[model samples]
Target: MAPKHDLQYPKGAQNTLNRYSDRGSYDLEKVHKIVNSTPVLHVSFQPDPSDPFPAILPMIGQMGSFERPSSSISDPLDCYLHGYISSRVMNVSRAAIASGKPGLPVCIAASKVDGLVLSLTPNSHSYNYRSAVLFGYATPVTDTEEKEWAMEMITNSVVPQRYDNTRIPPIPAEMQSTQILRVTIDSASSKVRDWIPSDSAEDMANKEVVDKVWVGVVPVYETYGEPIPSPLNKVEKVPEYIEEFLKESNEEGLAYATAAGKRPLPVKAKTNHDE
Candidate 1:
């Protein structure tokens, strides 16, 4: 039997990493995981051809296949973005579809800093981070079934099983007001830095400089605070799902960041700033 190999997004000029190329990956699994785990994504798109400035909006999005619902993260998936119906991005996407274009061109980015790398010099300082970028065409989801499914998936991405816990289905008014964009990705890539601080050999050999300068990684992770209830809430205690979600999410984040903080220095890591 042939060995199974991980699927990768083809590297192209649109989604290629130039500097620090060693840390970059085209693996679909790595890229999708970073995007799905990120709470907010920055989506950039041009409103019009004559517009001077491109618009970048922080949006909530999730990656999944509507046709193959059970597909894994490594499998190809479209990014589903939630936004207001009348938003500029949505309007542009709608217009593009109406004009018979494939969809509106967009770039989606997600990033998370796990640790702050304090090196010998300010120039050498960096962050232990994971970042992904995707170039895609954003088309408005017009089908009722697909839109609702995307909504449910996005809601669950925030808190596991959250969609079912709340309303079974969105009300007519809510459905009418919300808009979902299905992004067909052309290419994707991710870059990760998860090693201990790197410093030049000259700096490391200098006792005075090494003694004076503190060089290490400070782990950073997001923490979820206790849930505050609404004024009209009847329930005295928080739901178990909410409590468990917070605990598990916090633990997972801390573990990842802390592990990165303690990671051994890479053998081939660039010691000089220019390198």
Candidate 2:
């Protein structure tokens, strides 16, 4: 096994961070962390060669290793995406594999805003966020065991232990209707800005601009509110698992965002390519 810091996706044109490169990282852990944490990942692929536009779909995705179920987040892992069998992306991936192509070439992106950076100038205004982009080839999971495992993995990602809590095993119809796409990532990178506002030196020199403009960070985070029971909910009260997940997630999100708002900017611009 390689050392933890030695494990990283190779930097290339596809995954390089050009602008404000100081905030970028090619660390597999950081890239995967942003992807797994985000609620939705935007997957992009060209559906038709002749078409002018590429199709982008919002999907539920999780990073995990079926072969090594106990693997840590820092380890290399494939991205499992959950969708309906009839979805266009699933059909395209299936066709690509059938045609002898490696898989459907794709780009997946996930981003979460930690704070709003209010600067003295509009050009300097920016968002404190964690964003990751992954380039990969996606193929439909054909093996029954792997598909079912991926299903359970993805379900639990939404809410911890949700798969076992709700239903034992999916009915045949339910299994038939769902599809899982395993993306073999070729390269990936993440850009994260979790710091206080940065203003131009000229603007800082002018105390008038600083005095007039409100320069600060407005911390942002996803909040999970009190769970509302479904109309047909038979359980008298919410399960302890659900309550615990909500409490833990909400607290973690708020704390991270708050800390990001107060952090100092990155001291230097660095990228994997620089090495």
Candidate 3:
């Protein structure tokens, strides 16, 4: 097996994981943490069993959702559904690995922002974010107990205590309605980007041109709204568990909840005070 550290990529593919391998390698610890921290995985492989596989899966699904997005959406429902499907796919991929049919590795990415840095040169433009990526085969949970635990891990992975608050997963007979797969990790890497712009010689020469326009980066962030109770449930008072979900600050959690058919919290109306 090619150690994740030894895996190679075509030129132009940034090797961000090289320096962060010790912390980034998708080992058991990282895998568990990742599965718990976020419920998403970007999976791709040569679908053909023969060589010269000339096809790639469509990036967007029929519903206008993608395995990966260049930018995050503000809608919590959209975000949650995206993560739910992504996590399910990842689980299936892992199950394939556990079945002894080791498939291609998938990429998992999580990014956080510190601040944006503006620069005088277009080439120097960038932002600060803490990100980690894992390239590994997901191991399957075959044991019934382990499988259930994996499911719970995935559930709580999205929203802490979510499974405990909601109904526990059904037995295999009932779960059969849903598809589940597991994968074992083989190798992986991690990386980060946090550099500020340093003006190059040409940029310095064109200082006037650079200064003529605004040259600062606008920071990006993910936020959540209040929970909208289900129409079926007419309880005027919201449950603490559901209310706590609203107080949580995970974009992935918000996305997962929305995808699971939960409604987003309503926006609070503001009052005009002493005019």
lDDT of 1 by residue, 117-217 (tens): 98988888899999999999999998999999999999999999899988678999999999999999999999999988888888889999998998899
What TM-score does candidate 2 reach? Answer: 0.95
Better of 2 and 3 by TM-score: 2
TM-score of the candidate numbered 3? 0.56
Deviation (Å) of 260 in candidate 3: 31
Task: Give a tens-digit lDDT track for model 2, residues 177-270.
Answer: 9999999999999998887777666777898888899988899999999999989989998899999999999999999989998987655621
Candidate 1 local Cα displacement, residue 64, angstroms: 0.2
> Candidate 3: deviation at residue 9, Å?
17
Clash counts for the predictions, in order:
0, 0, 20
After TM-score superposition, the amount by which residue 187's alpha carbon in candidate 1 deviates from its true location, in angstroms, is: 0.3
Local lDDT at 17 for model 2: 82
In model 1, what is the error at residue 36, expressed in angstroms?
0.4
- Cα RMSD for candidate 3? 14.3
Which candidate ranks first by lDDT, i.e. highest?
A: 1
**How close to the true structure is residue 100 of candidate 3, measured as C-alpha lDDT?**
79
